[model samples]
Target: MSSERPKLPIEAVELYNEFIHGGMSRRAFMTRVQGLAVAGLGATAVIEALMPNYALGQQISKTDDRIKTSYETIPSPKGNGTIKGYFVRPVSADSRSEKPSKLPGILVVHENRGLNPHIEDIARRVALSNFMAFAPDGLTSQGGFPGDDYKGGLLFNKIDKAKMMEDMQAAAEWLKARPDCTGKIGVTGFCYGGSVSNNLAARMGADLAAAVPFYGGVPPDAEIPKIKAAVLVHHGELDKNAAASYPAYDKALTAAGVAHEGYIYPNAVHGFNCDATPERYNKAAADLAWGRTIDWFNKYTRA
Candidate 1:
């Protein structure tokens, strides 16, 4: 968890990213790697090396008093049962009862690794911006996000995909109906979460006022027509698998006459906005994307 971390060669990092992201199979990457073999590690070692330890990836501490936090069991009507989530609202939002001060709600969806510290911190950041941020643990029934990223990934793999969407829908509705909220909602997701945000926009229709999907896959062309929200997208050009659909999604949104903007950030790869993974973090791009996301939310949800 220390700042003094092990450094991996660029090639090794690339291969690990490819395998971790399903771009390549474990066997395929093991066969192509020339470095891990020299270190006397097999495929297992390569996987261990890429696993994230949550303690080291802190951008915002959990104890930060600027925001009020709650661990809640929200209704998950489409899931097997209720799902737990980490919710945050500005401390000011909590203390104020004025009608004009009612904040908009933002659903922060987690990636395949479930609701880890990074996503929790993201929710806090959104709270600091004065929105109610509810980040659900999609793997809640599977015991939520394991402290280690790899374990969470394993848990996520066993989940019911359809139920996950249902739970997400429930979370959105719960936030919209909250006492402190203004009934306007925006959703943002990263990686797998981003893909859901894209699909959720269409699924939520007029309920979702805005969506910001970062480095996520695009929804089907047919789904694009159902999206009533304004969308702001960010992706890393180097993440070819996710980037390949950019054009198709662009054309679909344009054809559907949706108000949207998409960007493929130069020199950034998938998860660039996730500062937790230093290997993929791109500060300039992350800053730009965050700004655009905030502006997008303001235009559609707040303003």
Candidate 2:
């Protein structure tokens, strides 16, 4: 066997600092960062561009407040002519049982994997957090499933952003009609879904109360000002995928005077919340981000 060994600990940091000073390629930085495996910090610190305040110092009380989730199909002018979606709502706190049925609502877009178990689980999670969460498969026509290939990925490739927004608009209208739901609405998602969230908020006009995108591609600068909701953005510091675009998006939001919070998880990579991908999963970061998302919606949508 060859006698090559890994780079030394001190040497690694020195190399990283050199790359930082020289403004070296992101690929080189990521490769070096992942290999170092820095102590106490995990691999995340190496790739994260900067450190975020890790102040999950408060205790989360387990309360009796409960929410329920379900699936429905609504008519829309899309590829399949029907928009299939999933939603979560509060069973007890719902206004329908009383006189007014308005409740804060949320639309969750899915990653490239389409409408899979993980996406449904996210809906349930959002319900538990007290918002009416709805997830519609942006690519329902053509083939079906998002996680697997149908008709050689052509169906997913044909996803039209404008139509997806229309489908979501229908879903929001459906919520508006529900006596158990409030009219206020927000949108959020991860990866391809996150990018959709950005585009959707801009297209949905002024009604959206909030928007949260996690590691998704950003839309153009002109589109940022059209976003009416307060936005919360999550990015992986070392992520090779979407890092280059997020800073520009953040700058645009700031310039537009939009209320927004953006966090870049250190040493994290793409798919940090995906437990199935252990290689990319970072429990601490995912948990923190989830709590923040809940807190954000609660602040805006509380009755």
Candidate 3:
């Protein structure tokens, strides 16, 4: 089967992005979708095409023998009382006689829609790359993801933003302290998770070895000097709302003497790295960005 995503109208994709990111109401999104409908492709069809297809984006299967996965709950006194995450690690090469070596850790943060299947798959991919991965559910305090992006987004909004950040920090600390970890940690997240990654880079200081925030918001100017981690930033050329702040952010990082780099992928839009959302996934950009991400982590967080 061909892996190419279907061609979609840019307007429809942007509308969907806005809706999912809380910029547009569902009623407004439906109305806009109706206006964008055309022959054979009604509003319903357009919505279906734009919605996330988790199966399409899953590069690794849960049953894959190369990795072992589990759910873990860690204390988060500063945020939610407890947070649960999907933890994954590469299986030992000599499963019959040897234990896996301690590995560098990567915290895989999700978008506003909690820890969905796509994010779990991402954690698995991190494990395949020879790192331990943990993806905490931002909505864990609200009964978890509710199994749908739209609903997940709603639940995420209910979470106290400050508390959410605290939960992520607690997760990072927990992951780094794990016996299987090498005491070095990196973070990579998309959309909301991307923002969290950047924030954690600032808040965790020397505790964070690296951070890769894809189309995430930049930290405040004051927070810039506090970042001790090597940072790699990714932005989509067409995601003007998010990309607009990159220049200033890059300049601030430079002035702070922070180690960092940034890239803007041409012809890409918000969520371009997310293959689950076919309308927005830019394969070339995603591939290039992923390659850079792994390299950055290895350079900074390798045990």
Candidate 4:
């Protein structure tokens, strides 16, 4: 029969120190600490640093108090076809006073799930942060409503990449038309959206002040050299889905001679910034990344 036993919080460290001091043989110590979690506890602590606290999972309460803004469905001639986007800008008295007279704009993209709550919330959050953020319905032919279930599964399979770019171009045109907009813009995205941001910065040249891709797949090897904007790429080191190419991406960015910042959180898995995924959420890393994003935009897009 196996019995489960718990060890003191600091016992693991003491056992290692005892080994070093020759007070106990390594074999004897290993047997005694086998089920004591000497290694598992340490691994969990390290994971906690790189990942979000399971305790804080309850702290995130959803609310509809997010800032509101206007959006227009428009046609595009740039890529595949017509593209529609949800646009957000500052509205409150405090925002008008503290924000720049002419603010820069941001293009927010959606994940494979299509234009949903998380994507919309991101756009609203960007507006709240004082920049004009536009989240284009990445799937237009499929559907245009926020949070609506779409017919197609993956965006690339249904929507042509070229057409998506054209649609994005139309959305950018809309932002440029705004009187308060400064004409400088940036692109950022999560998951599949991140991949688009990377590819766009390489494919689309004009008006991009910065590019921030979070846990996105990278573009082709040849496309690496085409990147034009200052890039900030975030990834999960432990992300099985995205980490395979992380090293190659780092090399590509370095070889391309682009000014970029690459962050790979040690134990973080895919979608660390996503509040929906309890396993992948990392509050500390998310906040830090967000702060960096704000500073990056401020540096590139400030009026």
Candidate 5:
């Protein structure tokens, strides 16, 4: 699909970074980028390259008979109002029980995009793996997910970071304490969600058994010692900032005596694990990273 999207030059990448960091307005960026196309650099191709193809986002379908699903609203004691999310767990085809077999729990955090269909799909995939998965919508206080075209930055800006963290902590603990859970909880996230995973893992410490952060930022070196969960970090070699942070994070993790593993997929860029963006997705890298993530969770979060 991205056959026409040429590899971007350093200049274009810098402009994108500036835009994401809020240093440039969208209008200014677009106007400048149009000049790139005029200059024969394929600017529109660059934007299309970053567009998410929701059709290819999820690995599993919601209607699969192998999984039981529900929408739940749970109270967040963290003063972030109520939390709402999609919950799923695998079921035996032959069993008619309302309650499925007890399994480990996983918190599937979404990208900066709130809890969209992709995340719901991810929850199902986790359930297929025989774990109970719950994906809380951080936009819960703002009425939850805001339909298909919701801009994440809008809801994100309205949220208080501390409140969001507290709410997630509540969600994790709630999932763990469920009668259907084995009490072990794990977390895995991509991009913004990945950064949250790292932050949550450090904050929750031993309470969170495992964390897999896909192309996410690491905590400050000084904060590394606070993390107790066994971590597996997947990074894209072409994501300069993320790639640069790996060695320092690895060193800090080692020094802090944390159990961890890290991988940098060659030639991949940020969001490489997300199959929705054809231009950025690296199937081989995504598959390898996903396998490692599931294996890491199985090893560390098993009952």
Candidate 6:
């Protein structure tokens, strides 16, 4: 966690997490915050501070000359029919070249709130790392993210989980088949996206080379043996729900002979990798997990 900003109470942060995760209504969340107000911080201030700051979390600018970006809509016959996404790639992978070198493709999945600015920025970061990245909006059928996480969460819940999986599968297949992408592909995601990463590994089989899920849920034991991708799981130590899943997940992977690794960062909480929410972002954990993610992708996807 960054010390530059005022630290928020852990209880309040936990309540906010629960609210965003659909454990409570917005009105209830607000009422609860009012009770947790401390010196120099009112309910309003706490709520505002807990909300994501997209600008501050953006590590790569959309206009940065190093990367090329575009919006693409791909057919998802099994899903909502069509899905839109933010696509990014290194400038060197531009199609204009006589024959651009094909690069590994990365499917960047966002949290429960659709493809928000922070996730778009993550795609840009992946592009700068020498891989082509695509991040699809799960709420595409609902008019996308709506530019507000609270509303986005509501919209996300309305989406059919099975259809959303198909939509992500479509995005991954589309990226893998692109002229500028190598046949190998990897997936990485945060929170809700993290679970998608894990599930995609099991579903895509040979089509997926690697999967890095940050604080995501574990797939069922029966699905474990189907995973062909090398898996890297990241969990925050204090994120009880996700942390508790790690041991069982790790054991299942080992029993299934799946290549995998799991790490629980000390003192971190759920959503620790999301810098957009300063109240919960753990810089040290996020940085370490990110570095390991890149290495895992390079090792598995680039091979």
What's the CA error at residue 29 for candidate 4, in Å? 42
lDDT of 5 at 262: 94
User: How many clashes in each candidate?
Assistant: 0, 8, 0, 4, 0, 0
* lDDT per residue (tens digit) for residues 1-303 in model 1: 566545545566677676665566556876776445434456555555555545666666788877779999987877748888999987754365455367899999998879999899899888888798999999899988878665777788788988988998899899999977999999999988899899899999999999999988888777899999999888998778788888889889999888999999998877888777766777899999998898899889986
Candidate 6 regions exceeding 4 Å error are 1-5, 93-96
lDDT of each: 0.83, 0.66, 0.92, 0.68, 0.80, 0.93
Q: In candidate 4, what are the lDDT values of residues 211-233, reduced to their tens digit?
A: 89998889889888888788898
All candidates in order of TM-score, best leading: 6, 3, 5, 1, 2, 4
Q: Which stretches of candidate 3 lie over 4 Å from their true place?
A: 1-6, 37-39, 94-99
Candidate 6, 276: how far from true, in Å? 0.8
What is the Cα-based lDDT of residue 61 in candidate 2?
17
- Per-residue CA lDDT of model 6 for 35-126, tens digit only, reads 98576777898999999999999899989988889999999999999999999988864555799889999999999999999999999999
Candidate 2 error regions (>4 Å): 1-67, 78-80, 93-101, 146-154
Give the backbone clash total of model 3.
Answer: 0
Query: For model 5, where is the 10-residue window of minimal lDDT?
Result: 34-43
Worst 10 residues of 3 by lDDT: 92-101
**Tens-digit lDDT track for model 3 on 1-303?**
866544668899889988998988889999989998455677888889999999999999999999989999999999988999999988876433455478899999999999999999989999899999999998999999898999999998999999989999999999999977899999999999999999999999999999999999988889989999999999999999898889999999999999999999999999999999888999999999999999999999974
Worst 10 residues of 2 by lDDT: 51-60
Look at candidate 2 and tell me the lDDT of residue 135.
85
Worst 10 residues of 4 by lDDT: 46-55
How close is every model to the real structure, measured as TM-score? 0.88, 0.71, 0.96, 0.71, 0.88, 0.97
Error of 5 at 116 (Å): 1.5
Which regions of candidate 1 deviate over 4 angstroms?
Answer: 1-10, 22-50, 53-56, 93-100
Question: Better model by lDDT, 1 or 2?
Answer: 1
Against the true structure, candidate 4 reaches a TM-score of 0.71
